[model samples]
Target: MLVPRQVDPPETPAKTRVLFTLVFLGSGGIERSVCNVLAGLNPGRFATKMFFHHRPHPKSQQDRIPQHTEVVWGTDAFVYHRKMLPRFFWRLIQEARQADVIVAGQEGRAALLACLAGKLLGKPVVGMIHFDWGAFSREQPRRQLWGLRLLYPRMRRIVACGHDSAKAFQALVPVRPEQLEVIPNFVDGDKVRVAGEAPLPDWAVPIYQKPVVIAVGRLENQKAFDVLIRSHSLLRASGLDHHLLILGEGSLQAELEALVKSLGVESSVFMPGFTPNPHALMRRAAAFALSSRFEGLPMVLLEALALGCPVVSTDCPSGPAELLEHGRHGVMVPMEDPKALADALGRIMDDEAYRQDLSQRAHRRSEELSADRALRAWESLLSTV
Candidate 1:
């Protein structure tokens, strides 16, 4: 059964429509990201709707979204594999005949579907890209040829989440660098800050009275929480009094738990699974840590800074290095270096002067990504198109 949307019904006053189509919502970074975008968008300027391929349907994260937007459920999670591919295209044509814009991420089933739907409806579409599809796709050539070659040039604009992502988008299309828009993820700074300041809940493990380090991301291989765990074990072995808290879940949970035991750092490491309010935890923690193998302006990095948490992130390509301003604002250890990460963690935990300096710089850096500022950037892009 599909989830019910409490919509106010279709009310296109000037027969104009704005739709943002996506694959799904919930359980992962991408889904949470789409929610943040949807949250920042003003409803008056854009009548937004999210079309999902698959969610935890009937009881999905979509259910929790404010009633201002409509969430439409699509039948196929996979573009070519879904039985209703042709029919899905047909219905998209039928529904989007008058839509002014269709927002889609580049090189996913959603993007392909949006491209097809736009062509059928004679509607202009915009591709929103974070990372290149080839980085994660099995049928790279098909997506590149059919999705990129055929679909990209036809779209009105391409939006990238960060500078690195914009570069990735450039590779997909022959469009000039000036044609792409690089809008960093926006943060509702005041709200996130307020939430972060609140005291921790009673259920949270109380290991970090003084030396607390926190990293937030799913336990997926891509997030490389395993690498962080291994690094944390090294930190503990070096006589550091710090405890590491990792928030979020994935299939690697059991493997990570086992590794913590084998490494004998169970007393100093805690995995409390997923928490919707990660900022709350981030605020109380002494510093924020990210160990992702790569990212498209990782939202957790921004959220941590906005909450006034000093950050130490892996200097992975894409976001953190840029966000840290080449090591001025936050510490950036080379990716997958246990000793380097341990050293960085130790500095943040043991050295107050350096940590406070980084914390101040982080706050200043976060101001660049204010939600209001980003909303204006979006407004500018929307006007240009």
Candidate 2:
């Protein structure tokens, strides 16, 4: 008779197991903000794992995830929930059962899945709100709103990246004041400083020689890059010679290119597709512009400020006004007004002293968005529940 050898018992994990669920890993500010939190968390105290319903997009900031953090790519799909809900829910239950806390990023299906899974397993769940609900609901479907009203109150806590987002969310859903917490988006200052101070990549060094006004984000309607291009055309006509460089790729690329050509400012406007590293461009840029119709504490604006570039952004709902502090740090132009945007651009370009002052303030203000502080706030929240 063969004797069975004695097996050693598995040791328990010392750190708190946390699971983060995302509908998809795409090139968005929310995805990058989550990555920043992963980078800053105390690894010894938090064993983090990320679950994605689909694979990360080619241009996504998925690469920013730390080496120690485990990532699981689930079944692939185009949209969140609805048809995919059963599959995602089942998978989430399997993944979330062992975790001490579940933090769900993105709204709609991801939030519903996390909340339901957490409820089933009795795990504490944090619902992360990355968009201004007032602005976001305008584009969402009826069922999404219904789902939010039904499921949001069940979450242990709701985290809003924008300072004003909590108040905006309360108008849409029936969440208690205690359930809402405001934590602004954060950027890696040291990473930005290093990447920005480095020399421009070979491909851009030639065309980027001119004073460039850079804007970074997916080339989508929400970003309103067409408005930025239109404003640039006006600036050119008014004798401003700075070239406009818009980074990131999206569906609006073809239309934006067409608009640039039609406006006859094609030579002055450059859309270089998705750039893996934008901090270098930010470092060399004369100014950064954000023309979004709305936002929830834009990550690019924070990165721009951290890199010491002055900024001009639309006073969109929830974010720009709070970030600029009513125009103390940067210029806040009226939303969707090309004339107003052009005027603000002209002011920054023509006045060297004002630009320098904005740049100094931008750097000083970036310290307030420290990744450590944001992560500590998150850790405290996670531990409490």
Candidate 3:
């Protein structure tokens, strides 16, 4: 008897291999956005790998990276020196060879390295702009600006986290309009809500006992935590009784602490650096405040809206006004204006009906900027690239 003829199995289409490169894996909005993209992407359609120029610090959110994606750490230095860049580029080329698409997870050195690798390998490179580009350009060195001018135009796409960021990039860089894409940062609303429901730590229990105005961000100059501290003092002076809680860690911690002390609001202000679950604090806080001098699309502000926490943010460049819909969903005050910030915070903390109205609008706005919508946009971009 003859055996049945053997039949071959149908071939499965290979997933698009995406290589994401970042300067480091620190606790910043860019890092968080990378982690979210890695986890949220459809695994069947895209395979993700990350290359970090420097090893993550102890406080880096490395644990949030998905298990399926491969992560490569290159160096330990906070910033790569010119002498070390040759080696970094060689390693990145090796990584880029295996990827179909290269993503510069952030601007600056990461974008430079990724662009170099993409050019060498003839791969499409997608660069990300995560800050107000005009402000960023002013702060960066001439060499950095030169690098952007020379390399960013070579990218297949330049993604700005907000429309204002896109406009800023167009003004600063001579990239074609078609090359720019404005895909605002987004968070997993369900996960954020779940995290928000977590029980507060023992030490933080008393801080939340009094109605608190919460702000979550690095203690860096851009975040303008000093402005928030000053506003807290103003609110106190005006007879609004509310504690101020600023979360996250950075170089300006000491300076900000000194500011709090100098203003004599240390008793009412708390700086608990780098907690994993700031959503919990935001969930219970009377108001969530953002006093950033500038931002691309603040992840913390989105997280606050996701939790339906009342928001009062500085009408800073790019993100907050857009996220808050020009004061439709939340209050927007002038940047670094302590009195305006203080008044907004007081309004939220004082008027229960108005706070509730903002809370309702916040939840609705979050749905429009949900993780699923962002993931779909990313998938479309990756597929085409």
Question: Which scores greater on lDDT, model 1 or model 2?
Answer: 2
Q: Please identify which of the two predictions, 2 or 3, would achieve the higher TM-score against the true structure.
A: 3
Worst 10 residues of 1 by lDDT: 132-141
Best by TM-score: 3
What lDDT score goes with residue 38 in model 3? 89
TM-scores, in order shown? 0.85, 0.92, 0.94
Residue-level lDDT tens digits of model 2 in 95-164: 8988999998878778877888888899988888887888878877888888888988889899999778
Candidate 3 matches the true fold with a TM-score of 0.94
Residue 119, candidate 1: Cα error in Å is: 0.9
lDDT of 3 by residue, 213-241 (tens): 99888887888888889989998998888
Query: Scored by CA lDDT, what does every candidate get?
Result: 0.73, 0.86, 0.88
Off by over 4 Å in 3: 1-7, 76-83
> Which pairs clash in the backbone of model 1?
none
Question: What lDDT would candidate 3 get against the real structure?
Answer: 0.88
Give the candidates in order of lDDT, highest first: 3, 2, 1
